[model samples]
Target: MDKFFKLKENNTNMRTEIIAGITTFLTMAYIIAVNPDILSIAGMPKGALVTATCLTAGLTTIFMGLYANLPFGLASGMGLNAFFTFGVVIGLGVSWQTALTAVFIEGIIFIILSLTNVREAVVNTIPLNLKYAVTVGIGLFISFIGFVNSGVVIKNESTMVSMGNFTSPTVIIAAFGLFTMVVFYKRNIKGALLWGIAVSTIAAWIYAIIDPQGAAYYKIFLPEGVFKYESISSIAFKLDFSIFNDPSKIWTLVVVVFTFLFVDFFDTVGTLVGVASKANMIDKEGKVPGAGKALLVDAIGTTVGALLGVSTVTTYVESSAGVAEGGRTGLTSLVTGGLFLLAMFFAPLFVAIPGSATAPALIMVGFFMMENITKIDFSDFSEGIPAFLTIILMPLTYSIGDGLTIGVLSYVIIGLLVGVYDKGKKKVSNVMICLAFIFIIKLIVSGIG
Candidate 1:
C-alpha cells in the first residue's frame, strides 16, 4: 500500500507537469485551427498552409525545450499572425509568397540581432509599465480575436455583430465551455484546462450531431487543404518564393522584418517577465535561469517557422496558466511539445474541437491579466496613468504594440510633466525608451498624415 501510494504521488506530479505544458501549448492552438483564413486571404491554398502551421509550431516547441532549456512553448505568434495575414497581405496588398519572404528575411535579421546582443540591448530599454501593456494587450487582443472569430463580433456595415446569438452552435459551445471550466476552476481541479478541452470536445461532437447544417459545416470544415479546421495543411512545406522580383517589395521586406522583430521582442519579453513572476519562475537576481536562452530559442523558433511558411513563433504567456497548475522545468515544456506534435497528426480531432470550448480558458486568463492592474501605484498620476494605459488600452486597442506605444509614450510624457525623469546614460533601457518614444511619435504623425 505504501509503495502504491508513492507511485500515485509520482504520477500526480508528472500529470501536473504534463498538464502545464499542454495548457501552455493550447494558448495558441486555436491559431492552428484558424490561421488559414487569414493566410489564404491572399489565395494561399488550404492543405499546404495547415500542414506548415502545425509542423513549424511543433518543431519550434521542441527547440524551445531543448535549445532554450526553459519550460516555454512556441506557436504562430498572436499579433504577427494577424499582421502578416492581414496588414501585409490584404491591407498592403502584398502577395502570399511575398509575405513568406518577409517572414524569412526578418527571421534572419532577428538571428543577427540576438546573436549580436543588439536585440537584448533594445529590449532592456523598455519600461516595466510599457512592457506590462504589451502582455496585457496581447491577452485582450487574443480574447478579441476569439470573440470575433466565433462569429460573436461580426462587423456589420451599420454596426458589428458584436455579441452572442445565444442559439448559435459556436455561441452555445463557447458558453458551455466557459461554464464548465469556471465550475472546474472553482472546484479546484488540477488541470482544469485539460478538463475543459475534453468537455468541450464532447460537447462539439454532440453539437455536430444535432447541428442543422451538420453535414454542410462538417464538409466545409473537412475541405482539402486544412491541417486543422483553421490553418493550412502544408504550412511547413509551402514557402513559394516567387514574389521577390520587385525592388520596392524587397525593401518593404526589410521594413516588415524589423517591425516584426520590434513588436515580438517586447511581446515575448513582457509576457515572460510577467508570467514568470506569477509562476514563481524568477530567481533571486530577477531572472529565470534559462530565461535569456529561452528568448534566444524563441527567436530561432520564429526564424524557422517563418522559413517553414508560417508566421512568427514566440513563447506564449498562456503557459503561465500551467505554472498556476504547478508546472516546472523542461519536463513541462517537453510534455507540451509532445502534445502539440501528437495533435498535429490528428488535425481532424483538434479541428473538431470547437474554440468556444476554450472560451472559458480565455476568460480565466483575462481575470489573471486584470490582476496586474492592481499592482500599479495609483497614488501618482504619472505612474497611475501609464499603468492604467497598460491595463485598459491593451484590451481596448487590441494590439500589444499599439497599447505599448501608448503606454511608454504616456509614461514619458507624464514623467516629464511631473518632473520624474530618472536620468541615466549607461543604462540601455533609457536609450531604448528614447528611441521607442521617437518611433511612436513618427507612427502617430504618419497616421495623421
Candidate 2:
C-alpha cells in the first residue's frame, strides 16, 4: 500500500488515510438526499436520482483515487444542479431529458479539453495571487453555505440577508458544534471536526426525541430506516438524444452547452486547486500532478451521471475536510468512494445526518482555507484588489464561476491601470483578458435572454 500510494512520501499512513476518507464522506454524504430533492423539481424521479448520484459519486471518486492518485471526492455539484432544474428545464422550458443531453455534450467537451492539454494551459496560466484567492474564495463560499444551511443566516425583507433566530434548537446545536470543533482544533486533535459533528448530531437527536414537534418544526430528526433501496430503472440509461434532431432548438442547445461548459470549467479548476492547496499537494509551479487525469475522470463522471439521470458531477469542495484530517494519498479517496457505493443501500441512514451536524466541519474547513490569505501579496494593490474581490464575491454572489471570472477581469484591468503586471514581470495574459470579455458578453446575453 505504501509503495502503491507513496504513503511515506506523502507523510500519511493507511490508518490516517482511512480515517480521513470517512471524515470526508461524513462531511459530504448529504448529497445523497439533497441532489435528488433538487433534481426532482425537473420532473425526475427522486429514487432514480438517488441511485444515479451514488453510482456516479462512487465510481468516479474511486477512479480519481486510482487514476489521479488524489484524495478528492466527486459528486453532483450544488450550483449546476440548481441550474439544471430551475434555469434549464423550467426557465428555458426545455425538457429534462434534453437538459441531460446538453450535460452529456458538455462532458464530451470537457473530455476533449482534458486530453488535449487545453485545461492544463488554463490552469498554468492563472496568476499565483489569483490562485491563492481561489482557495480563500472557495473557503469563504463553503463557510457561507454552512451558515445558511444551519440557519445562522437567513433571507430578510429589510436586508438581503440577516441573522437568524439563535434561540432555535437547530441554530443552538450548530453553534455548539462550531464551538466544539474550534476547541478541539486548537488542542490539535486529529479528528476534531468529526468529533464535533458526532456530538452535535447526538444533541440534535436527543432534542428531537424530547421535542418531536420542535424537531418536526426544523424538519430534522432520526430518520426511521435501516435501509433504502431505490430502483434505478426510471432513469438508468434513459438519456434522450433526440433533442439534436430539432434544428430550431440548435441555438438554445448552444447556449445551454456554453453555460454548462463555463460553469463546470471554472468550478472544477477552482475546486482542484483549492483542495490541493489544503493538502500542500501543488508544486512550486502552481500545478497539480495528474491534473489531466483528474479532470478526465470528472468529465467522465458528469457524462455517466447525466446518462444515469443526474446533473453535472464534479469535485466537491468538502474534500478539504479529509485533507485537514491528515489524508495525503489516494487511499483516502478510495475509502470515500467505497462509502458512497455502500450508501446506495443505506440512503435513509445517510440522509438522517442533518445540516446542523456537518455545518461545523465546513465552518472549520473554511477557517483552514483562510490561511491562504496570508500568502497573497497584499502590499501590491494590483494583486490585493482582485484578491479581495475574489474573496468577497464568492460568497456574496453564491457562485464560484462568478467569483473567479470577476476576479480575473479585475486583476487584468487593475494590472493594466497600475502599469504593473503579475509579479511585475509581464503584462496580463491575453487569455485572461479575452475570458473576461467573454464573461461580460455572457452576462449581457443572459440579461437579454
Per-residue lDDT tens digits of candidate 2, residues 1-449?
Answer: 89998999999999889988998999999999899999999999998888889888999999999988899999999889999999999999998988998999999999998899888777767788888898999999999888987899999999999999899887888988999988887898778878888988898888988999889888787877878788888877767777768898888899999999889988898888788877887789877777788889989998888888889999999999999899988899999999999999998888888998899889888989999999999998888999899889989999888898888888878877666534566478877777778878878987897
Model 1: per-residue lDDT, tens digit, 1-449? 21322324324356677787787766557666677556676677765666677777777777766665456677877768888877788877877667777777667777776787665554555555544544455556556655754546666666534565666666666667667777888999888877776676577666666663762462223222334333544454456556566666666666676667777876777667656655555555444445656777777787788767778777776676566566656666777777677776666656545566666666666666555555456776766777678667766766555566677777766666555455532233466457667767658754874
In lDDT terms, how accurate is model 1? Answer: 0.65
Question: How far off is residue 429 in model 2, in Å?
Answer: 2.5
lDDT of 2: 0.88
* TM of each candidate vs. truth: 0.81, 0.96
What is the C-alpha RMSD, rounded to one decimal, of candidate 1? 5.2
lDDT of each: 0.65, 0.88
Clashing pairs in 2: none
Once superposed on the true structure, which residue ranges of model 2 sit more than 4 Å away at CA? 420-425
Residue 299 in model 2: shift from native, Å?
0.9
